[model samples]
Target: MSTEKEENQVKSKKRVSDHGEVFTNKREVNAMLDLVKQETERVDSRFLEPACGTGNFLVEILERKLIVVEARYKKSQLEYERNAITAISSIYGVDILEDNVIACRDRLLGIFTKYYINHYKKGFNEQFLKSTQFILSKNIIWGDALTMKTIYGMPITFSEWSAVNGSMLKRRDFQLDKLLENLEFDNSEINLFSDNKEPVFIPQPVAEFPLTHFLKIGEYE
Candidate 1:
């Protein structure tokens, strides 16, 4: 029951030729994500799409996570906001095209805003929205994933946002190249031992910021 025009898989032939851009349709996207249904539904599970184009995949993941967040914590505005932020913070994307990157961010933000406004309407907090925008600006990158650098030719640094003491968030910046460095080491080689005696490779953060209240995080640099 689908028409070719309704599919909207390719933006244009020029884009396909220039960037090899071909978006996955909704049906296919859902089918692939269903393989990891549990992770998609998890409120805090992290997902990174290196070649995300207009966020066809990332938006679906956020919607699934938000559903769980709503079902569990919708009664409490603070709780919903906290868990919602967790869901958004965990979803990341990188697109080589500037226009695609911008569209992806907007789509993800629109989905989040729709759910939020539907639930709380006029009661929604402005600070929470600002925090979400700030997190998205960092999580969604405008760069070449293959090079692990931004369009400006600088190393691509991602902020790891961890919630501490319920309301405070701790942010640590890690370079994309450094984070991928662990792949070079053999998994069988036990380079470091974790608390449970499990092998772990912990990459050092390039920068760490002071703990800031989740709602006020946007105010910080």
Candidate 2:
């Protein structure tokens, strides 16, 4: 039974690789993590694997996130294992293939499940799965990063576009001297490399802004 399960996993992995997905090597990951620490930035748990085959990239990300959370709480291996539920929810993954997607989600759940047992001394709860919104449809999209200009699933609204009073309206706020006048807009996603053939999407973590939750304007005030 164990051999059959292992073989099934191997076949599932192949489905993702066939689609030109390349998981990052361990060597490159270690070097990058070193750089990240040297730079000393608060990294987000939201990581994208452009070619996440069987979730190799997510596994590393999960481990790193756990380390960070442990550092935050000053926990040992025992304490870390005890608080695994909260740790597992932070790391996320995206894969193009159906089987790969399922595998990635399942593995992450397994990580959290063991944590539940460690903490509560029991198995996973059914309600926990419903609560974990880690894997979203848009999160793991099936598209060519090169050709895909904009993320189609999520819509950009006027509220997402902000300005300093009427300065943006007069094209004075952002110093749009470089951008074409025709391309100027009061509301947009605020592209960084507008003219570059390959656009870059870097996730920023803001302290006050909560994790992608809906915020009513009047509620905070």
Candidate 3:
């Protein structure tokens, strides 16, 4: 094997032993992502990568979603920016390694910013850029998935961002555990006394930050 290959293998083995980290090759990453190609292309579709090591999956998903945004909204700058930010906010990831979390955030943001600049010759909007970065900071979390807690030991939470009423953005936060559990239902048994047929899991936002515009997210103290 080449010296670089050998070094990579050694590092991979060490990471696997230390943190169960096994980096997926690009081919395998695409093959896996292909299974959900349609969802990846949908700008508003929500995706969560439980062990997103440097965003192998999230990066590709964002790329696909951006393509759709560009095709549909390139003529309308404001429309495109709003949808693009929604797409970025839709992706969620959690990693035990702090480095992986930071790298993934930067990678995803870089992809979006690059696309934004290519389309907008006016360079880039500062407010839009900052707001997108803020969304990423919330979506890509550093934590242990098994424990469902953030690196700070607090319950991991995620914000669901939706573009509503044309220009307004609605933000709803939910705990990772509650969102995952979803109130298990027993389909085998039916309760006659209950007015509701099955247990409903309505996600309640622990906190919310609504924005009239993407730029407004920064203005909100």
Worst 10 residues of 3 by lDDT: 188-197
Q: How far is candidate 1 from the true structure (C-alpha RMSD, Å)?
A: 5.1
Q: Which residue pairs collide in model 1, if any? A: none
How high is the lDDT of residue 200 in model 1?
47
lDDT of 2 by residue, 78-151 (tens): 34432343344334334445666667766655654544455445433444443332323224344333433223
Best by TM-score: 1
Q: Scored by Cα lDDT, where does model 1 land?
A: 0.86
Q: What do the candidate models score in CA lDDT, each in turn?
A: 0.86, 0.41, 0.83
Off-target runs (Cα >4 Å) in candidate 1 are 1-11, 183-198
**Sort order, lDDT high to low:** 1, 3, 2
Question: What are the candidates' C-alpha RMSDs?
Answer: 5.1, 11.1, 5.7
Output the better candidate (1/3) by lDDT.
Answer: 1
Expressed as tens digits, the lDDT of each residue in 115-213 for candidate 3 is: 999989684688898888888888899998999999899999887777887767877788888766646555653321122356545456699774557
Question: In candidate 2, which residue pairs get closer than 3 Å at backbone N, Cα or C atoms, i.e. clash?
Answer: none
